[model samples]
Target: MRHLTLLGGLVLGLAVAGGAQPMTAAPATTPLSAIAALRDPAGQVIGTATFRQMGQGVQVSVEARGLPPGGHGMHVHEYGRCTPGVDPATNTVVPFGGAGGHFDPGMSRNHDDPQAPNKYGHGGDLPMLNVGADGVGRATFTSDKVSLTGMNGVLNRSLVIHANPDDYKSDPSGMSGARLRCGIISRNGLTTRDYPLPGAQDFPEGVAYDARKGVIYTGSAVNGTIYAVDAASGAVSKFQEGGALGRRAALGLKVDPQGRLWIAGGAQGTVSILSPDGVTLKVLQTPDSPNPYINDLTLAPDGNVYVTDSTRPVIFRVDPDLTLTRWLDLGDTPVKYGPGINLNGIAATPDGRYLLAIQLNTGELWRIDLRSKAVQRVMGGLERGDGLLLDGRTLYVSRNAMQVVSKVSLSADYGSGQVVAEEPLRGLRFPATLAAVGGDLVVTQSQLDKLQGGTPETPFRLTRFRKF
Candidate 1:
């Protein structure tokens, strides 16, 4: 926050956080501090912010231009997403609305100074900025309310510059004016990545997240061993050995609403139904076939479990009681695979009327009518669509080979789709699957390309992106 005087002179300069003199130089071994670029809804990069560790606290330098001439409130927002200033229909000040409110870890929800370090103000609240007549401003200050490391760290959070000045005592953020720009903070220009199952030859082909349990589940595609990952800590532990887990490879996983862990046994031609405690209660084997590969499974609101068979041109169905049967042989589309793998990812519509499945080898998205058991190709050429997830009308397809997540919008008829956007996740080694926890999406970096060449010391990890 700026230290102001009666003369209206902007009085804040870059200083060491703990009141000590600013360091003349960063150590050779010490890496550079964090940085972020604030962009408005129109995708204009209007401001830049940096975080540097100083004597007592983290020092933050903020520089922006083209802002209102005078004081404007600045703070970190809760969400990383930066949305437009107005709802097209409402025409209200929704600027950076997707970034949510101030970063209030606690529900205090008040707007106060970060220097106070009290429960009264939000931790995100910072000093107001004073733009000159030129509409440009640069100020640096330290905050005791934030840290460069630890759980309360600012990484991945959104930095926002507001339109109006902060009164310093308003109930919520000094009733700060609409957000003008926002940028997600990060270190070394890196994305939010967790792990690649982190070990030599560890390929996590599938990931299943249980929001209720606060746990994520995945397994080794090579040995069919199941492991549990701590969502908060990134800790990995062996949950179930391969002895009881059916099949040669554990490919896909889903945590059903009933708390059961449904696993697909790739190449084993079966699905394993396990208790929440990791006990294999039953194994539902697909009908006898030359080569049956149950690749993935998703639970439908209609109380049925749907499985995708990559080798067979069929969608397998498993009842709540563990009874397995051929729900539909989607013979409408021929099998287009290289190594006996085709249909890989499956998702059920919220209305429970249609099933959307994507073929791995061909990148074809097919919509299957649940009632008639008929299949229709909605679109094709997704380029290695491995995991398919539906949230409302948006379908997120993870193209493993292309190393990108394509977000498609489904038409009202559910028979067609258009690529709305693509999240180019270049950091992903081999993202095989995706799961949504809350509004955030987590991707499993199976690193199959590395693992395929045989065991190496590099471990695989998960990459996460927050939407809200």
Candidate 2:
């Protein structure tokens, strides 16, 4: 009687300290959620877990089979790998050995009970998973110690299920046996054809992605903030806030060969050089004489940077030593929207001989000779060109106000081209810019037109356009 009473008291105290209250029915969660397949050592998926943002907390909906119709110790593990291996130190073969201990980013190592949300244990602890008679368990659990946003978030972490059930009070995994299931979390949004940028209300006009690092980056013009997404983990964090960028709007953004970010300073008469972590390195300022309204930028094969000016008639060039020079002068070229202002988008040839630029007034594609400064109209009637992306011989032109993207094929020389296809994006509010991230076309819905017209609602986003 005395032992049972003491045990009951200990459980109650632990539960109270950890704030272990009954979990309520899950309400609708924010769009910050990820799905991962629970797999065995044989690479066979046995279940799935979807982690979602629930208010200030997080909730994971788990569903699977192959259990023994009893309680199992299911937890978030430390490592993301799920392959079976031998622990090198001991050379002991284990099930899902690649998935290390419980996921405790801070290395708390205090494997406390998941129900008791106290500071006594590792944040990865979870409640005992109850499997039914049919060997399938379906349940939802919530936690306040971890979330899906900002640094050190739970994305990219692994979920693991033990062969035995948890004893609840034991430290360091509750004597749970070998890991039977393991899987790494992935953003539900990125796995689909269209990736959603939730809560982006500013004019999102720039996008940059590193396929190797699985990082997705975009910037907001109004707020002047840069946002980054860990494509592997679905964790979203602000890479840079606009205040550090002064009043200049981030328009066209591109990653250079040196892994630095070259940003177009719209109407700021400058180009900003940013570190890979979104820190401002230097500003390539223009001469105040012609009033450069630098809008978009691209790197040529010669390692020089070329930027188009929306107001001025010339394109600015940045040399290796940060020397700013006049690259090409369009001299009031007739364009689709009329003369005076032209050359909104620019791209350089891979061989470093010619440069392709679009005239905003005439919708004509012009190829400019790099050495002679000679310009010729290659293709005409490409209206409202705002942003241009070149893939092989293909050119993608973004018509900001029109919400349309035109894809065309250019000939070998700086001469002619044909329209391959067009994608309408105006339905996305007001898409203003684009970037190619891996196999998809990343489009930013700037909503600049609405802001210009005194629209009450302002919502911004980076919409992924996948090529079928």
Candidate 3:
């Protein structure tokens, strides 16, 4: 069978039949855990193993069937490949020889006991795996020498099962015989910390960060209550009362350079601008007769605010002087608005000459030229895209229904892009938006999918994904 290797961080599987997938530098991971599926020479998956972080050590569990009924050796190999190759020492072909030798990040070159320290033994050394009469073997243990992340991490490594038992004292491989099965290790998810909100059913939707005061701002989808969280302590406080100034629901939020909050009034067809002191400075609205659902907004470099209406095929713009106007209408262009939720998230290019928005139903990205009033569909699919954040030429799309964050690298003109990575971050439950604060990604767990006559998780929280 064909084999595909898994790389840690931003890089995932290798090239498949169609074409090569885009890859980039690895992202920072902490206390990472992994799992592997053991495959025999015939490409048949026979077993599995799991690795987890527990305190300062790593816990390992392995279970396999259809093996010899005796003691066998198991080790974390140096490489992540499971294909056959020529053995350097034997000058002959070896089963699963591509995995290389035992993992020895410290370069100790010793295959001592697992209980020994890293300086004295290889980090991959473990106790012998004993098989029963039913050809089933299982082992569970903890090791302090190896880690799941960092320099000594094994996320992109390989696990191998040897034919003979380990002697615990022999050099190189403890007199273990030929390798029988090998599996490539892959990461499960990034570690996360939760910052809970106050109400049991707040259903927080949007997130924004104020660097000056080191605070995070989020709003409630249920009643438009805006809450501020201290970046250093995760302390939650009310920033604005719910449903103030005829605003029924709050969705997307952005903190301007002047520290004023630009709030989107969902389904109210209005946009409210509030000062840092929680006082409403101004409110803008669209025509109430046709009805509109203002879902998200973005701040441009020229100090203009662009908003997206989910129900209507139109975009509204608010000038720096607080003057609101109908910026662009998709009905007048080639872009078609589907039946369900249309445009959800809005973001502008750094040059302020173009704006990019996502259509949830069609999963299409549209680019609008501010200078020419021209609109064109960007080349990429981001279905279920809820929030959009642009950092230089890279765009981050939060897919709420898929429970994944897609990293897209845009071209120079912002007309085309490709998904470089899609990470399913841990502790995210129906994530609605994303905010970069102090090198960490703050994501809101809106839980909106379960809001149909069902009880939401108590004390809904925002998660901090530690990504550098």
Top TM-score prediction, candidate number: 3
lDDT of 2: 0.67
- Candidate 2 local lDDT, 1-468, one digit each (tens): 000000000000000111223222222122456777988778899999998756556788898788788888988765556777665445797877766666653445577777544345666777777899999988797776555532224565688888788886676688777787888876543322334555545677777776766777777676567778775455678777776758447777878877788778777777888888778899877878645577788889988988888787778899988788987666644333334447777888888898888877677788888898777889886766677888778787776654456677799885898765544421333456677765557677675754644331223455555531
Q: Which of the predicted structures, 1 or 3, would earn the higher TM-score when compared with the native?
A: 3
- Those runs of model 1 whose alpha carbons end farther than 4 Å from true positions after fitting are 1-190, 196-199, 245-247, 332-340, 454-457
In angstroms, how far off is 395's CA in candidate 2?
A: 1.0
The whole-model lDDT of each prediction reads 0.72, 0.67, 0.78
Tell me each candidate's RMSD, in Å, in order. 19.9, 19.6, 16.4
Per-residue alpha-carbon lDDT of candidate 3 for residues 16-58, written as tens digits (9 for 90 to 100): 1112232332443434468899999998999999887665567
Candidates ranked by TM-score: 3, 1, 2
Candidate 3 residue 51 Cα shift, in angstroms, is 8.4
